[model samples]
Target: MAHATSIQYEPVAEIGGGAYGTVYKARDTESGQFVALKSVRVQTDQNGLPISTVREVALLKRMEQFDHPNVVRLMDVCATTRSDQETKVTLVFEHVDQDLKTYLEKTPSPGLSPERIKDLMRQLLCGLAFLHSNRVMHRDLKPENILVTSQGQVKLADFGLAKIHSCHMALTPVVVTLWYRPPEVLLQSSYATPVDIWSTGCIFAEMFRRKPLFCGESEVDQLGKIFEVIGLPPEEEWPTDVTLSRTNFPPLMPRPIADFVPEINEQGAQLLMKMLTFDPLKRISALNALEHSYFQDEETLTQKKS
Candidate 1:
């Protein structure tokens, strides 16, 4: 890997930061193009590169190889020696104008137009389908991780929590963000690609409602919130052999998607319900979702405009 000092780029501004490191908007000195630089703090001790960092870098590199437009492109990865002489890994990526969270905050009361929502959702599902087909689970699919360019193109970002899924391997249930976490994950049941679909459903609903569908303070509370909307699924709905955390949830009536998100049309509601299905096996896949009537209308509208 090249050292950050060898790279020709000037930091423009600090964009965001978390426990891992800070992200900045920078200009590539050679190409005169703007890019996002994410700096990850590394442990120089015997531990070496963090597993999270390793997984993220590997996944991003694989995505780069495929050059999927819906997924954020990882431009480069370089190591930088800080003033303390400790090495930090920096990831270079195509800069997006804003995240979906900020975009929604800036939109007016009624939220985005139906067409715009459909456009963004289509892009999200396309990216997710690409990831799922490759056997990768985003694990953390939230509004903050979905980037939007000035041209209205949506790209999936933040692979830090992502992992390659295999039937033989058991994954941690404590993966996705609280608001967007699926019922299976909360219930500590073995999950797979459908978890991403569940998060996508939460994000899809948030696009129309401008708020999270299930805002829970704790795991139990989150399950309660989900049950409040969709009702508790009977034991028969889940795999008979596997054990679940909250099997005794109060019997609640499932509310109609239209009643929950009145802004979305009937077709949109139908798709959302399928994505948010209690059973992961029954949840709609990203590719199947892309084929839904909701996006078909968007396709017709786009063709008309052109």
Candidate 2:
């Protein structure tokens, strides 16, 4: 709610940039706290501000009311007039030390410990459960969208691709990044929260393997990679009315989870299996995932600590 001119902050460094805008790490003068300032390039049409920006701002505002720990908090929203008469919208967010991608890259050869991995996954699923309960679907949920703090806390970030889900409506299947996309979305079928679950599963695997589980080169190739590992879903498994682009997919045999990611324990593998199920209806919900046996030990430990 504060005006851009009212805040005094010195840019420390450019953290990241993309098609949307550049993010900078800045020190807030008033609060004396480090924050991330994401400067969005405003592309106004007859309708005024870009819909993506509008949606993101609105969603973040809504999320602020709940103050979920695993969800990134929007500190402020401000705008500045450019020399060219255009306005740049800067979204101030709580600063995070690094993204999951960078953290994984810096992780040692064997990757994070099982306990740490469980904690991260728990936080991710907790955040997702909160989002889904609020009827919001984070369409893009890759490692890059997951933020990590120095103290090992995980927060979900980047809501630009997110949208409020209505049960009666049919959303576009073009959501989510390629590797993390689910089969329903790839087939242009009507989808909902399960799409996010699929992405979460991808992130879950990456946490242990330090690489994407399904690294498909193209959409077709991506589907091939998925089938290569999980095998083609039988016709009975397909949604009754949904039709896929290719009915004659190669009958690749499904490999055991151990073959792809042996580092994870059997319980972790079981959770991954449910998350990666071909049928969206069969995929594990975030709330249910939190109750999975894989997290039982961690839950017990947390309880003991408390």
lDDT tens digits, residues 1-306, model 2? 235434576789888763245678899998899988876555455666556667767877887899999999888887665534345677788888889999999998878998889899999999999988977788778898799988888898866433322211133232335899998887768889999999999888988889999988777788888998898888787666556544758877788988888898999999999999999999999999999999997678789999
Report clashes for each candidate as comma-separated counts. 0, 0
Candidate 1 lDDT, 52-130, residue by residue in tens: 5567668668878998878998888886655353557778888888999999999998799988898899999999999
TM-score of each: 0.83, 0.83
Off by over 4 Å in 2: 1-7, 41-56, 79-88, 160-177, 239-244, 298-306
**lDDT score for residue 301 of model 1:** 81
Q: Give all candidates' CA lDDT scores.
A: 0.80, 0.80
- The RMSD (Cα, Å) of candidate 2 is 4.7
lDDT of 2 at 196: 92
Q: Residue 214 error for model 2, in Å?
A: 1.1
Question: What lDDT is reached at residue 93 by model 2?
Answer: 86
